[model samples]
Target: MNAPRLIVGLGNPTDQHASDRHNAGFWFIDALLRHYPGQMRPDTKFFGDVGEVRIGTQVVRLIKPMTYMNRSGQAVGALARFYRIDPEDILVAYDELDLMPGSARLKLGGSSTHNGLRDLTAHLGTPRYWRLRLGIGHPRTLNPGQSVINFVLGRPSAADQQLIEQAIDRSVDHLPVLFRDGWEIATQQLHSADPAMQAKKEAKSSNPKEEAGEKARRRAPEDA
Candidate 1:
């Protein structure tokens, strides 16, 4: 059998950080657990709780590093080494300030000013891991002295929290599809606007009178 894949959710482990914007990664994992219970349990060696679940014939391990966001690499590194899993097989989920709320993007790439990813690359010595980035829009204005930290660590307003939670739910639903199908197919299914697509199809099936009127308008100009 193939070695299990690791899905690590990056976040700080503290009551204070539980609902913070920076902890969106953990929020996703929490939502996943709610959807599929009894798949994970606490494992102290990883410096966090670890859970295992089977999707088809493949077993995927879910991890939440206990170390604070900046030091997440340590816990992840330890888990990867113990499991003998390659970096490419590891999937990480985290929040991205550049993306708008209630939106998410999945890609495999290098760290981009993301402290968690930076430290992770430093420990793993590679930047080839998969990532699911949850969007948490940037603050309207900048503040001095650890402003970035404050912005990420702060709790979101009620409306923003609702949006983030909705995104999390969608992300969790997409995970099973991701494992069952490939990324491209799963992404389209998850991100595509179904209602908008239906509307477009309906518009194409306009009344016969409207189509006839449009044809008459075109022919009138030619006749003149």
Candidate 2:
């Protein structure tokens, strides 16, 4: 809704977890930093690596939590409190297992399967912040016996990884629209399947929840 917002990318902070599906948040931020080239430095005070980038004069602080995935609240809560940023002024990006790989959805509120989100919601004492859920897909879809923990901690196949990266790449183009024009514009432009149909589609909805629900269309495992 305003400038100088905090954009947190969630992930574990270790080399071993670097390429795991659970680290999709890290990968998303990595792609962003590569595109925008922020001069990120490890900030002990923030308990994470902090950096800034100006998109048409709006300063967006990009943060990669160093507290690991399970304890993201430490870094996120500290940074937001220090900066006096409201919960609505923050946007978090992370992997989602329920959607197909190469897909992405931006919305507000909680997650069903992400521990990082649960930690964040707990620390913030609310689920009002925005979220960019990058689909990494579920490994159990391909194998019934695969454990969700093992699937997320394990590295994705090269093909799946590329798909996830591409999804992030496409989603990155809407960062400016999201920060400047807010949620509706970001969702309409980014989530719509066809550019020509976006305006017509947006005209059909006034509620962000309805819009996100209709557009996001949460997909669960058929067997589950």
Candidate 3:
């Protein structure tokens, strides 16, 4: 597979949404800009903030949709269609509620209950693109009776935010592997470094109650 030509960070584009868990994608993009020499500027044609950075030999375009979370695809679709970039060569980074904070996954396909991803697939016409699922964790798992909408739109706790930021850094560090090597190797390298995933595995193996809680958490609805 070709190295990704476009890397999109899915998030609502407003100051109000900046620290929300739903803006994990934006946070990742910000982190990337810090590590790689790049600047984000608003582009009307793309309906988003667009930028680029060279990784190895690949010039990867980065986008942060200016549209709200539900309409995320509009900006992505505009930029992607104009560039004639194939869906397979696009990577989108967004938050995930299923995994615990401090864990992230790189994978292709599967939108699950993520509205941003669902809209992205609708516009891109396929779910074949790569994804960086930065785990924000579910409210039901962390705090009982909290609504999904409130949980996602609200800022994460200080400790959780630290974990999420750590996860973002880890994901950013492995981009070279994803672009230079391939999905299989990158997935192995990325997943192997996820401490949260390892902790979850240990909890599942040693504590049935914790495993059951995890299952319930997955089954809970993510949208309001």
Best by TM-score: 3
Q: State which candidate, 1 or 3, has the greater TM-score.
A: 3
lDDT (Cα atoms) of all candidates against the true structure: 0.79, 0.81, 0.91
lDDT of 1 by residue, 136-212 (tens): 87875432354777889988778778878888888788877787777777667766533333454467467777767
Estimate candidate 1's alpha-carbon lDDT, on a 0 to 1 scale. 0.79
Q: In candidate 3, what are the lDDT values of residues 46-154, reduced to their tens digit? A: 9899999998888999999998989899999999999999998999999999989999999888756899999999999998999999999998898789999999999
Per-residue lDDT of 43-78 in model 2, one digit per residue for the tens? 998889888877756778888899988889888998
Instruction: List candidate 2 segments past 4 Å from native.
Output: 193-224
- Candidate 3 TM-score over all chains jointly: 0.88
Query: Which pairs in model 3 have colliding backbones?
Result: none
Query: What would the TM-scores of all predictions be?
Result: 0.79, 0.83, 0.88
Q: Give the poorly placed runs of model 1, Cα more than 4 Å off.
A: 1-4, 141-146, 193-224
Candidate 2 has an lDDT of: 0.81
